[model samples]
Target chain A: MRSVSKYFDGGDTVANYKLDMEIDDGEFVVFLGPSGCGKTTALRMIAGLEDPSDGEIYFDDDRVDGTPPADRNVAMVFQNYALYPHMTVRENIEYPLKVRGVPPEERDERVAQVAELLHIEDQLSSDPGEISGGQRQRTSLARAIVREPSVFLLDEPLSNLDAKLRLEMRSELKRIQNELGITTVYVTHNQEEAMSMGDKIVVLNDGTIRQVAEPQELYRRPRTTWVAKFIGSPPMNLFEGANNDGTVQLDGGNSLPTTAETSSPTVSLGVRPEDIALSTEPPDTDWTVPGTVKTVEPLGEYVLVNVEVGGSVVNVKVSHTDAGPGDPVHLTFDPEDAYLYDENGELVA
Target chain B: MSVESYLEDRLDRDVDGEKLTAILVFMLPGLTLFAIFSVGPMVYSAVGSFFTWNGFDIGQFAGFETWVATFQDDAIINWSNLRALEYPMGALPQNLIWMLVHVPLSTLLGLGLALLFADLRGRSVLRSMVFLAFTTPTVVIGLVLLFVYDPQAGIFNELLRALGLEGQVRNWVQEPQIAIYALIAGGVWVQTGFSMLLYSSALAGIDPALLESARVDGAGRFRRFKDIIWPLVKPVTAVVVIMSMIWVIRIFAIVYAAGGPSGGPGGVFSVLGLEVYQAAFSTPIEYSKAMVVALIELVIALPMAWYIASMD
Candidate 1:
């Protein structure tokens, strides 16, 4: 709810660092980054599972820096779905409430309501081992929901599911967030998951917030080159070069014209693979670069063409009918779509 | 589908043909010993209880008369001192001495040793020393205590002379009222090590998360032990209890080498196990009555053994 910074002494190499973030009410924010980015650590700090060496966390203006996990009123779903092994599905769902001393009558009523909501009423008497992975996931969801906690912490909850189940559960998770409307913080290394599921995504790297925005804004316009490179599949192609008046020059004798005002001697160039076009001859587009045909791979839907340009191999996803191995090719990428960065990997444009 | 043909086909084709025979071969030694020494004796005892016979002869049909004789004889009163009966000292009153010396004393001492050495850095050294007495030969154990309890020339009374406490150093083993307890002390010292090691391991196996959970649930230290630790250790406690019972009842060697029959002084301290020896193989062989006494012991112990097994 307010300024929270965590300084961790992660041994000699990265001796100290802080993770700072603020969450407003009812925000389905995601802490997104690659592994070892301390995104999970930050989320845990917010949930009161880990404490900050400095700074304060507030839940609607109440200092919660030292509150225990149970008293923090945040329910977490671990990546492995840490359901109680010794309990029935119903008992697993009812455990938090039972710990809080809720009466059996009210506990059962709330449990039944949640079981119905998750459609796990039939499996209530079954042990966790008897349920499918997805059903166990639902049981974990029901357990968190039955507590009616103020905050929901999801630590890569969908990462353990198979691809198909992950797809299905993503929609289910989004639906639940919409229905409950509790303030939630999700952590994941998957960019697409954060893009699709988050109302506001916090992109983190190396214990720092790289960028925080809605999905479309974060993708089309990233604040830093790390964000630009990390959030896209076959990530944004990046190279450090200098900007000429109408073109940019690479280390070897190759140059592409830039549309941005950068009179600096050094800069970084970034382009998404999807935006690059492969042509047998040069395409009559706003931007063109010479290249030698390297190779072509035919996936069922499209062809991935690799071209050696500016002493670096660049890939373009092309239509299958227009490409083959060892064909003469020129690569073209949109000039406006190019992102410029300073030497520090921060956006220059 | 003859059973032999099915078995032949399965052994010839479906099974890993060499594996079955190899496993049986590997198991032969232990299985044979178990059958001969452990299982065979149990089954033989149950079956042999139905007939009246000496150890080397053919038995006759008695149809529970042996069992009836076990209760009707005066030695039945001599076998165990039950609390319900208001009676004078049969050989029965001697076993009540076990309840006095071995019950809470050994249990508390074992628990105390386990707690004291539970966290020490050099705990294994202390444990090894305690366990040394347990591993010492029972004969040597009796001889050592016999030397310690000697009336005129013993090392203990001599130390008492050097310390000028000779009045306190009485003839401990020669006193009928106290010799049983003195011998029980030797067994207790040896046996408490086994229980302490067991309880220590039991304490370690308790889930650390359960302790944290109890703490978060507002459990204090005593409350945690009473409500959580006690129930989890109940099964282990049952095992220790049964082990004490068996060890106390079947104390053959300690009695044989320490005070023999008639308890070494007057006939003041003698329990059922030694009573059996005194009846069976002393000056006159009272073989028939000794067999009946052994039968009575089997009856008392069989129920306890069954309870221990079921608890597990």
Candidate 2:
């Protein structure tokens, strides 16, 4: 995609979308964002299901902006699977080949191959309504990949499944993409799924691409406060403070040393919950900020403690914590772990 | 604000008696009207079919005499007329022709219009214009068609004259060979709008993603409709066909209005429904015989009604 934009309602409602990106052949890229963020629109544009209001889309070396979807050699799995409810599983998988006028023997052979690959051979004769949701998903996958299209797209395909089934299909989808080696674009609001499945995650906000990088890079070095807050589970804790010399003065009347170089007087400092250490006893350094604990949530491996500092709550993840609500506590982080952002929400260092 | 808490403030006693009273209060009006209007007439006609009852006097028990007379009535079931290709066909076979011609043409035209208007700009306005005929009373539609098919003043002849096919123009309603077809065409026009509306709503209820997915799966426009859309809307087609079938079987007022109460135009436009009306209300009324014909129509319609009910 090169500078692609879309407008709805005769261009009256500008969607805030202008996309320019590339996906290498066989790369599994995930477009991650919240609802109404235009991630699905971008995917649809690539699949030729939607035409760009401006710019062009290229597949390999050919410009395909004017091509219809059937001739584009792209297949998409819709959010609901969108299986042909009237057809049997075999017929559904064989539809593309049947439409393209492939020979009976070849079509059967390909349908059987894709069905075995998706582990749905036993469901071949069953109607789509007769099968379970997970089986229907696999059948849709079979249908999409049976044509061996150069590009594949999926729009939140696992969102309708049970949590456990979603988790299982997550890895299954990744494995299928790797085996097929077709360039895939997956749209989802789930950051965890993006992190685990994407070769590179494209984080979007308000219809614009915020950052596109490896998941680990996005988590560690987010370019904007929005990305920083969006990528993490508990999210990064941010507080408004003033930067003076080589130290930052917290709004709660404490000062912490920072390594980030910034000339802005007013800045927002951030640190991930896991990067901050919580102590029941007050630390012996001025680098520590004292607060009262508001809530504690215990996971099997760690506890998320919400501490009130300067009338705002900051979450800290620790290996173990016995502090309850209203208990006084202190939080400390090394200067190297703190991130400095200018007032514009752009990363300053 | 919770349901249990809200209920706690109210007195709760006599659950069974109160529930029964509420159920009766809600069901009484609708059930009473249904029994009086629908079931009562059905039973009365059925019992009347077995007796010698006239409009004004009680007569002897007819037993199966009226039933035998229904099949023997040349106007009702003319076996020789069944082989005729021209005028003077039996009313029963004419009703069959109405089903064969009007039902499919109306439904398929409706489906075609639905597909054409599916993505067209200003579709709502176009749909309303097309549906205007259906919203009009059928008698009014018949009257309008009668004028439109008039020999001298009708625009149909003007259109034919303008197209330079002046020789094809004729008196469409008065001709014995063409009169029933003219009424059938009017029937199709009135019915297409109803089926079109039904088909439009059915098409709207389908998930658009299904079509989008098919487009991406290498299916072209015609192929997608043939495989996906047509199959999905088959239930709606069944409904339209069955309902239209019932309408064709009991067709009376439109034909009567266009051809007069005697089903004139040399009686070629007379149908079973018209024959029943003529038998009951014509001079020397055969009330029981009319009931017998009504019962035959009931027999044909009952299975379709039951089938529609079982679809749920």
Candidate 3:
């Protein structure tokens, strides 16, 4: 897609911005954002379900911007699965082939093969209404893959499943995509799913792409404060501070030396929850701030401690810490672990 | 109190004596009206079919002889040289032919119109214009069509002449051979809007995602209708079919208004409902025969209603 934009009602309601991106062939790219953030709009534009008001889309070397969805040879699994309730599973799987006038014998053979691969062979004769949600999702996938299209699109496909089922199907979908080797574009708001399943994640906010990078790189080096705050669980903790020369003054009267080369005075200091270290006594680190523990939540593997530092609460993830609420502690972090951003929320380093 | 007893007391509170009395009091008027007007009339008609009586006086009990005469009477049945089948033509056969023509034509045309107008601009306005024929009184429709089919001044003949087909013009309602077909055409014009409304409402209720999925699957418009939209709207189709069949079977008001309660020329457009009215209100008033004809109409309608109810 090259600078594609979409408007809903005669250019009054803009759905997407001038988004430009390239998805390499056979790569699993995840469009990640919150609700109403134009992730689904971008996916729908690529599927030819929504027309781009400007710019053009290309499939390989051919421009397919004005092509219809049927002519695009792309299959999309809707968020609801959208299975035909009246058709048996086999008929639903064979519908594409049947519509193209494929012979009955070949259609049946292909239906059987897809059904066996999806483990829905036993349910071939049953209606979609009679199947479980997971099985219905598999049937939807089977229908999409039966045509062997150039690209496969999924719109939050695993969102309707239970937690355990969603995790199981997450890997199953990846395996199927790898086996088929089709260029797949998945749209989801779940950051964890994007992190775990995507070969590359496109982080979007308000119809604009913030950053497009591999998951680990995106986590370690976010392009903006929005991507930094939106990417991680419990989120990155940002402190309003001012940078002066080679030292940044924290809001709580603490100053830390930074290697950032920018000369900006106003900066927001960002640190991940796990990057902050907590100690009962003052640590031997040059970048240490004192705070009183406000709350503590314990999970099986780790504990999250919220500390009140200069009227702002910062969460720190610790493993088996003896810290409790109202306990005085020193929060320390290495200067290299800090993300510096200017007043405009653009990353400086 | 113990927990089980306490729970039982809570459950029993739902249908206490006062509540039950209140429910009965609220239901009394509607139930009484239904029983008196609906159930009472049905039972009375069934009983009256077994007896020979006029509106004023009771006659001797006539068993199933009136029912048998409904089929065997020569006045009710006649022979037609119009078609291949040489069997006796009667009110029943006439009603069946009207059903065969009007029901399918009305339904298919209505469905086609609905599909055409569903997504078009000014759809509501167009639909209302189509449904104007249904809202008009059947008597008015019949009388209006009577002039439209008049031999001399009717627009139909004028158009036929303008088209240079002068030999095709005829008295549409007065010709015994083609009178029933003319009536069927009018019936279809009025009833098609009804079926269209039924199918349009059902089509609106369908999930649009289903259609989008079919489109993504590369199914064309006709294939989508046949495989997806048709099956999804089967219940409404059944409703439309059965209702149209019942209307065609008991059509009387239009025939009376157009042909003066005797059916058109040669009784070519006679139906069972007209037969019932003629038997009950004509000279000497054969009330038993009227009840027999009514019972036959009921028998035909009840099975279709049952079949429609059995569908999902």
TM-score of chain B of each: 0.71, 0.88, 0.86
Runs of candidate 2 with Cα error greater than 4 angstroms are A1-13, A255-259, A280-287, A322-329, B1-84, B121-125, B287-292
lDDT (tens digit, per residue) of candidate 3 on A284-345: 87888899999999977889999999999998998868888999999999777889998888
Cα deviation of B41, candidate 1, in Å: 3.0
RMSD to the true structure for each prediction, in A, is 7.0, 7.1, 6.1
Docking verdict class for candidate 2: medium
Evaluate every candidate with DockQ and list the scores. 0.15, 0.71, 0.66
Task: Give the alpha carbon lDDT tens digit for every residue of A245-343 in model 1.
Answer: 767786545577776776677787787777887677767764666667677777877777777766787777766536566666766777777888876
Model 3: reference contacts kept, as a fraction: 0.78
What does candidate 1's lDDT look like per residue over B176-294, in tens digits?
Answer: 55677777787788778777777777767776544443333334566556655666666677777777776676666665677766555444455677767876677555445566666
Model 3 regions lying over 4 Å from their true place: A1-13, A263-265, B1-56, B61-75, B81-90, B144-171
lDDT of 2 by residue, B1-312 (tens): 963345444536444555656756888899899999989989988887888875746577778999898887777776666666766576777788888999999999999999999999999998998899889888888789888988799988889999998998998888887788888999999889989999999999889988998899888889989988999999999999998888889888888888886676657778888888888889779898888888888888899888988895
Worst 10 residues of 1 chain B by lDDT: B80-89
Error of 2 at A208 (Å): 0.1
The CA-based lDDT of model 3 is what? Answer: 0.85
lDDT of 3 at B168: 89
